[model samples]
Target: MSEGGSVKRSRCFPAALLAVTALGAFNAAAQEPPLIRFGRGFAAEEQVWLMSARPELTPNQGKKYQLKQILFQANPERFQAFLAGELDGGTAPGLAVIFARAQGVDMKIVASVCLEAAGREWFSTTYMVKDDGPVRSAKDLKGGTVGVVGIKTATDLWARAGLLNASVVPDKDAKIFPMGFPGMGDAVRTGKINAGTFVEPFYSAEMARGGLRKLFTAVEAVGYDHELLDIWFGEKFLKAHPDTVRAFLADYVAVTKYYLANTAQAKRDLHKAGFVRTPLEIYLKNADWKRDPAARVDVASLDKLSKFMLEKLQWLEKPVDVRQMVDESYLPRQ
Candidate 1:
């Protein structure tokens, strides 16, 4: 699980110098830079696209890096490894960035890895129950059981916030059953839990299982066009390989453009990655993937997200100034 815990929406912070200290062993071993290994979490289109190009980007490419696929279930520990400088750097959720910073991890957003072509939306949190059970809407679950990917996860956080805003508290109105991302959907279907909060393929999967309904979607609550995710790297890695990082970014933009332009092929590859389902057209059309020239760090957006996480006391301390965390000198200005 991530380092931080959930807090009330009104939580505040007085700020601190740094609650986490650097790992000394990492600094000493910095002389022999390790190979580049990509970290993956969840089966979003971004991971599918990235996985296809792994060889050229890693040890197979004769580069001092090796790309390994880690399940989203292991992202937290993998992210901690990147922060400790044991691994080069990799992709993570936007919320992971917030939690990593709270742990004093030295990392930065490299580029917009994925954007929502379909836009932010209240994706259905699949809810299931006995054939005779009766519950619907965020309001219907009072004193019921709700399944989720994890506590303090972005999905869980927003679900709670949205329910409260709707006047339904999870603990008071319902109990949250946390499970790994992979198992949550099936668990819901088997009647082991009531509803499950998930993203992408799993959300679609739950619906396919039948008898499940969309309670609420994250996008509906946060606005449809919200930038809910990103990819990032360690600051040290960026400083060590500026030219390489830039080349990777250029390729990333090109690759994503390719993915969008030839979405047919992209879907084929994505489906092979287990990130999508059959009928390529539906996945292509339904996927919220998007890209932009301005996909570089949006300081304003980052600031808002950072402050929101801090003010919500999602971390051990307040977030540092957004400027301190994001350095856009590498990205060609839009």
Candidate 2:
């Protein structure tokens, strides 16, 4: 009888352990918050905010949403991922989104990511050349090649516009060569390209390398305050999870405010993220962290960009309805 009782107790112990394991899993599942995958660009400012803000904004009982940031090397990749449903939402250039919509990709601009504010130079793409290189101005780039991260991207368009502002006809006088952002500084440094367009970390990195100077920034080329990047969401994601989207925007706004307020912490986060190689002060001085907490999408600015893409660049076949493409309802309520 003692031997039978010992075997029975061992079997009961195994069953009890299994019951506990299953119950723990069930409780965890119940507590897991809804996740929204966000595709972000490879900019230092954005990365800093993403690193610092995600923790503060998560697990809100009132919001009920969690954010998962997905990094993309370029806007095209991010846009493609959003189209394929790999990303719930992400940022894309206003022109890129407009062009994608013209091709039937159903997406909406939920908020502004980066913008050029009047009397203040927010983060803008910069065109750079060797400090002592022969090219002194955009006109000097005539008959030579300029490296751009991608064709028809904001960087590319901005470079072209800079050249045009200097009375140099792009593609006619100066040519654009596609190169990765990581390689652009080297390309210009080694004389592989006459000039290269760089954004944030790359711009800061190249500047820190001690042999480059800015020919012009996007703000100078555009001649007015414009929205450089915008937060967007696919139609399917919006339809399935509107509340989650709203919650995310609310959290995102709070995160942006936190980043703007605590720039020193943001620089440390950027360094930790492997975006900055130089001292924290180098990044702090070079990068501009000026995002509004409201995340407002500037319709007039977007419309102007659309018009520029359609008329000046001839990249878009026609103008897109900037108002229709923007959905302001998802922005965080004040």
Top candidate on TM-score is 2
**RMSD after CA superposition, every candidate:** 17.4, 3.8
Residue-level lDDT tens digits of model 2 in 29-110: 8877677788887664463245334465434523476667787878878877876778888877787888888788889999
Candidate 1 per-residue lDDT, tens place, 1-334, comes to 2334434322433222122223455554564434455566555545335445433322223333234444444567778667555666666656667677767878877666554233343233333443345656667677667776667666665566556656776677777777876777667667777766766655555556666666656554443333455667788778887765665555556566566566566667767766554456556545444455445655565565566556653443755665666665665445
Candidate 1: count the clashes: 12
Off by over 4 Å in 2: 1-32, 44-54, 59-63, 117-121, 273-281
Q: How displaced is residue 316 in candidate 1, in Å? A: 4.5
* Clash totals for all candidate models: 12, 0
Residue 182, model 1, lDDT:
70
Minimum summed lDDT over a 10-residue window in model 1 is located at: 12-21
